[model samples]
Structure formats: structure tokens, C-alpha cells
Target: MPSIIKCLSYTLPSNVYTNEDYYSNFPDVKSVNMEKIGVKQRHVITQGQTASDLAQLAAEKLFLEHSIDRNMIDFLIVSILEHDYYTPSTACVLHGKLGLQKKCGALDFDLGCSAYVYGLGLADGVMKSMGAKNVLLLTTSVLTKTFHPKDRNSHFVFGDAGTATLLTLSEKENLGPFVFGTDGSGFEKIIIRDGGTRNPLDKNSENELKDEFGNITSNANFAMDGIGVFNFSLKTVPTMIEELLTKASLTQNDIDLFVFHQPNKFLNETLRKKMNIPEPKFVHCLENTGNTVAGTIPIALYESIANGRLKPGMTVVLAGFGVGLSWAATIARF
Candidate 1:
């Protein structure tokens, strides 16, 4: 049995923030052309909202649009950079909120930009191993909440959103042959320093400090080595794509559309041009969504299908590289 993507749906927070808004909030922040980054505006969750809330909204939309029965879904997999709580998995919480049957399996995985691709692989493996028929894969992030309001390096780079994808067992193999890579040495390239058990919060963790860029943040806030991440992506992503193409026995031209994680306009364009992927064949959806971490790829896929860039029988390549120094690429036929 092969995993087939049945449908994709996404939800964005109601609050809108833009580069101009950042400038207004932090006048000392270095000025950068928003066009170059490919983000004019980003949606952010307002107070009282959580990633699970966004995930639930997206899942509800999927259920309504596809008329899917909650009982029929055998597994629920959630990929998120942050969860609402520390104990129970977000997937289990979602399972109860959605009124899924007690027989359903649920779990959560911590991942960043590469989450959607990884979730697809996990779903395929679980379904194949357990003979499960249906799986709901949800990817989401509320990374903005972890960034200091004055942290220019990260505050302007992330947005809040969630995506829900349905994968069902089919005779035809529409997904697989994935290539994955990890470089834990670059783990510090993007990270939150004081939240996990490794570094529990303390007085110093909440104390604000200034970075070289004049961005102020606490040890508890999200911090990113922008230059380091840029270099890592340039070095690893293209090679991963090539390896994936080789694994799938396909070439650049064979893929009808290339959907890479929407980290930023510059990095994405750079990778596309390096791979010699023509403009029409590349899909970029970060203009209004910003970098929604794990949500970027699926949201882009949803928009691609809605706009007719993706269709049944069309082959698409999905790649994601980011936090954890992790990256993955895979081929799927719609």
C-alpha cells in the first residue's frame, strides 16, 4: 500500500503584522527591503490563541470540506515546533477535541521547517506497518510567541499558522523514496535556549540581553544565527534535492512543480536558480504567510492545488530544511 494525499487545508491567525509594523515597534531595527525577503505581511496569533487552536481550526475545515468521518481516521500525527502544554501530546489533545474514536492512535513530533515532509514519511510508514487506512497529518507553529518583540532577527521572520493533510492508503504509490539529512553540529543555528529540560528557566533566562544587531531578547526567547542558517541551507538543500531525484529515478524536468519550504524569498530563489528550476515550476507562498515553520509547505501545496498549478497525475517534489539542522526531500504524485 502507498500513501496518497487526499486533501490539504490550512488556517491563519486573524492578526496581521508587516515589516512596517516592525519598523514602527522597533525604530532602531536595521532597515531591510521586505521585497527581497518575499514577505510584505504575516499573520500572527493574538492573545489567548495557541498552535493547537489553529490546528483545530484547520482540521475542522478539512473535515467539512472533505466530509471525512472522524472515526475513519486511524492515526493522527502532529508536527509542531511548540505545543500548548508540556505533558500530554498535542495530537492527543486534538484527537479529543475533534471527537476521534478511542481506538485511534495519536502522537506529536517536534520538528521545524522539515516537519511536513517528515510527517508524510512517518504516516506512510505507520500505515504500511499497521495496515491502517487513513491518517491525518497536521503541521503547525506559533514561533512568533517565542520571539522577543524587539528581536529583529526573529520577530519579523515567523508567522503563526496550521495545516491539515489527509493521507489514505491506495494501491498506487503516490508518496515515497525520501532523502533525509541531519547535522546536529548546526543545532545552535536556530534555537530556543531556556525552555526545555536541558536548560530550565531561571532569573537569568528572563533577563534581556542585546545582540550584535541591537536586537534585544531574553535567553528564553527564540534566537537565530541568520548567516549560519543561510550558509547551511545553501550547502545542504541542493545536494539533498539531487540525492532525492536520484533516489526517485527522476530529474528536475520530470517534476511538474517544486515546493520547497518557504523560509524567505531570497534563499528560496537562490536554491531554485542553483537547481536551474524555472520560475514557473517553482512554488513560493510566503508572501502573505511569512515563514510558518512546519506549516509553510502544506499551505503552499494547498494554494498550488487551488490555483491549478497542481493536479491529479502531476508529480511534485517537496523539500524542507531548517531548525535542528535537519532537511528532507521527497517525490509525490497528485
Candidate 2:
């Protein structure tokens, strides 16, 4: 049996950060090139909300909005950059809260921007694991929390959102021929210096450090090497797309829609130009959502469907890159 994505739903935090909000928040940073950044506004979580909170709410929306039957779900998978606890995975936590069947298998993995496509890969494995009929894949992250409060360069580029994807097992395959790549050397390109076991947090981590660009960060805050990341994407993504197309034994023209992860406007546009992809065939709906990290591609898919860009009998190419210095692409028939 092959795993097929059945449906998708996404939920954004109520709070929003507009271009005006960015200017007002940082008086010294007078202006932003709205055309270049391509983010008019971004939804963000306020208060002490965790990624797991958004995960549960998104699952609720998936069930209520899609009229899904809880008992029908045979397996559950969640991919989050953060966890509700260091021990029990968020998948088990969500399974209990959503009141799934006792026998339903559940697990969670730590992944960032490439999570959605990677989760689908995991779903394919699990579907074959036990002849599972239905699998729930949730990608959630409060990535905005990772940014330094005063880091003007990268703060506005990320937004908080959680998305749920439902996959059903079928005899015919709609998803396959995936190409995955990783370069661990670029790990620090997008990193939180301390928190994990490799470099545990301490009181010193609380002490704020200012950079040459007047940006503020700490061992506990997120910092990205913008230039390094841009060059890495430029070098990696186009090649990954080619590898995926070759693996599927198809060319770019055969693809009906090209949906890649939206990290920011400049990088996405640059990559599109490099790949020579036409504007009409490529999907770019991130003006309102910003970079939702793992949630980016799925949210784009939902909006694309709502606007009639994606329909039955369409072949869509899904690609995701970033945060593990990882990239992956696959072909899926809708």
C-alpha cells in the first residue's frame, strides 16, 4: 500500500506583526524594503503559548473543519522544533488530548523548516509499518520565539503557525521518488547556541550580547548567518530540484505546480530565477504568513487550494529546505 495525503489544515496565532509594527518596534531601524522582503504582515503567538498548544488547536481545526472521524485515525506523527517536555513526545500528548484510539500509534520528531516534507516521508514509512490506514502529520513551531527580541535583521522574517496533514493508505501511490540532502557543516547557519544537551543553558546564557550591527542576542536566542544561508540555498535548492525531477523521471515542464518552502522573499525569488521557473507555475503566497518554518509549504498548499490553484489531476512538486542545513523534494499527484 502507498500513503496518500488526504487533507490539510493550518492555524495561525491571533497576534500579527505588520511592516508598520516592525518600524515602530525598532525606531532606529527606520525602514524595510517591503518589495524585497515580500512580507506585508505575519501572525505571531503572544503570551507563553508553546508550539504544542498550536499543534492541538490545528488538529482540532483539521477534525472540525474537515469533518474527520477521530476513531478512523490509525497512526499519529508530529514534527516540532520544540517539545512540550524533554521526555514524552508531543505526538503522545496530542493523541491523549484528541482522544484517539488506544491502539493508535503516535510519535514526534525534532525537525525545523524541512519538517513537513520530511514528515510525509516518515508517514510513508509508518504506513508500511503496520498496514496503517490513516496517519496524522502535524508540523508546528513557535520559531519567532527563537529570534532575539532586538535582532532587526531576522526577527520579522519568521512567524508562528501550526499545520496538520492527514494521509490515508491506498493501493495506488500519489507520493514518492523523494530526494533528500544534508550538510551538517552549516548547522550554525541557523542555531540557538545553547539549550540542547550539546551546550546546556546556564545563568550566563541570560546575559545579553550585542553584535557589531547593533543587534542583540544571547546564547539562548536564535541567530542566523543570513549571508551564509542565502548562498547555501542558492547552491543547494536548484540542484535538489533537478535531482528530484530526474528521480521521478520527469522534467520541470511536466510539473503542474512548484511549491517550495518559503523562508523569505529574497531567497525564494533568487532561487526561482536561478531555476528558470516561470512565475505562473511557482506558488508564492507568503506575503501574509511570512516564514512559518515547518508550516510554510503546507500553509501555502492550503491557500493554493482555496484560491483554485491546486486541483484534482494536478501534479505538484513539494520541496523544503533549511534549519538542519537539510533539503528534500518529492512529487505528488493531487
Candidate 3:
């Protein structure tokens, strides 16, 4: 018996923001069911809300439900594509918010999409040898507040939410092997063009241009080559999962549940069909919370376990891909 996912919980803002109603400002809103895309209405943060605020809410919920003694937790890891501030990691803010004093180690990892598996691996290692019995992993994506409302391509798809998962060394559970991959060359395939040191806001104005649709287009704004990302996912995800299972000496049949990142309803369905996985084993949470970046899979897992869709002793496969052109997979025994 080693470290296992003892329990997990997640939360999202109560508001829902979508381009569907802003027909005048954004003309591309369609009638398609948001659920069809793996999200119905995504939670929207209220004005002045920050990523840390959402994360705090989720962490508090998990903390209260488990009644975990904050001092017993040894490490805190925060993963986010966007943070509330450029300085002092969001995890540090969460530490102060929770008032968990004791100079517990805090780290911030800048990753998009494939972070849970990566973070879980790091947490598992820390809890085993750090003289700590528990570790807290929190992830949040507040892309909704970052993207301009006029940008229809990204506005309707991205959502804001936060999730927390507890990992601890326990005697009554099982944990599985992990497999990870990255292709930095395709990093530009899905990215936000501006706001980084490479292309700071101080750059010349002429370098930017507007699209034919009159939308101010820049490398800084979020632009995703949908077709390219889709092809990358469908072609690479199955192989990644296969290799993960192989390392664990398991197979598709050995897994009772398949929890992949909620990229989109259409893409998930396509990959599911390609992998020949039955619908019953797949977990989809796009309806209520849209694509929550790093928050998607964990939130879905938390909901499933809470609703009894996931039970103890069940074998589950977790995979995540997107942003950073990165992908990761790991098998877990629930």
C-alpha cells in the first residue's frame, strides 16, 4: 500500500458567461447544444474574481469535506495556465487564504491541460519521503476572464473553474504507473500570442494587425488551430494510453473507467469512437462547466466518485492533452 487518491473535490463560479447572447457584439453564436461540445453552460467568475479565489473555494470545499488537518499536509502544488498575478505563485495565495502556516513547501507549475497527471506524479513522490502524510494538489484555469469578449473563436469554448485532489499514503488502496510525453515543437499550435516576455506589450504597434472580421488579431491573443490540435489528439492519444497500460501490464478491458481531459464534446466522441471505447465507461462533464483546462478531468473524476459512478477497486485510466502541445497518461486503482 502506497500513496493513493484518498478523495477529491472541485468547484466552479456560479455565473455563466457565453457569446450566445451577445449576438450584436459577437455574431458567431450558434444554436448547437453547449452540451454537444462537452459543455452546456460554463461557470463564470464575477467581476474582480481571480484564479486564486476560485481555487480557494474548491480547496475549502475539499478541506471541509475531508476534515483534513492543514498542518498535516506537507506540500502544495498549484497548476494554472493563467494566474491571478505574475508574482508570488497562486499556491502561496491559497496558503495564506487557508492560513496553513508552518512554512510548508509551496510550488507553482505553469502548465496547460496535461497537468493533473504531471502534478500527481510529483505529489506522490513528495508524500512518500517528505515526512508528510498528505499532499494537496490544486489546479485552476481562468481563461474566460483573460480572453476578449469580441474573440468568438475562444470565448465560447473556454470556461473558468478550480479543482482540488488529496493524495496520501494509505494502506488500503492501489496506485498505478505513469507515462508522459511532450512535443514542444507544436507549442505554437495552441497558444496565447501576447502578454509574455517574448512579445511584451511594449512592442511596436504596427507588429499587430486585425483580421478581415475586424477582430484585433495578435500572437498574444488566444489562437488555436483547431484542425491541427484535433488531429494531434486523435492520432496521439490512443498510442499514449496504450503505452501507459502496457507499462502497467494492463489493457483497455482491465480498466473499468476512462477519464480523459474534457477537450470538447465532439473531439472526445471522435477519440472514443477511434479507440472503440463504449460510452458507459467514458466520463463527460462538459455540460455544466465547459472546458476547464486543467480542471476538467479532476472535476469529472470527483463528480463520478461522489455520484457512485466510480467505486473502490475499480481500475481507471487518466489522460490529458492540450496547451503546451503536451499529453500525459496514468493508470489508477480506485
Model 1 C-alpha lDDT per residue in residues 1-334, reported as the tens digit of each score: 8889999999999999988887898677657544588887899999999989999999999999889887899999999767878878889999999998888899999989898999999999989998778999998898998988667767677789989999998888899799888999989888889978999998799788897766688889988888889989999999999999998888888999999999998999998888899999999899888999999999999999999889889999999999999999899899
Weakest ten-residue segment in model 1 by summed lDDT:
26-35
Instruction: List residue ranges in candidate 3 displaced over 4 A.
Output: 18-28, 32-35, 203-217
- Steric overlap count per candidate: 1, 0, 8
State every prediction's TM-score relative to the real structure.
Answer: 0.97, 0.96, 0.91
Q: Which stretches of candidate 1 lie over 4 Å from their true place?
A: 29-32
- Model 1 reaches what TM-score against the true structure? 0.97
* Residue-level lDDT tens digits of model 3 in 1-334: 2688888888888887644443445555554633366554667778888888877888889889988777777788888766767887778878888777666788889788899888887787777667557788999878776565466656666788989988888785366688889999999888776678776664552254555645554565666777789999998899998899889888789889999998888999999999999999988777777788899889889889878999988999999998788998887787
lDDT of 2 by residue, 176-228 (tens): 87888899988999899898889999989868888776678888999877778
Winning model by lDDT: 1
Which model is ahead, 1 or 3, in terms of lDDT? 1
**What 10-residue stretch in candidate 2 is worst by lDDT?**
26-35
lDDT of each: 0.89, 0.88, 0.80
Ranking, TM-score, top scorer first: 1, 2, 3
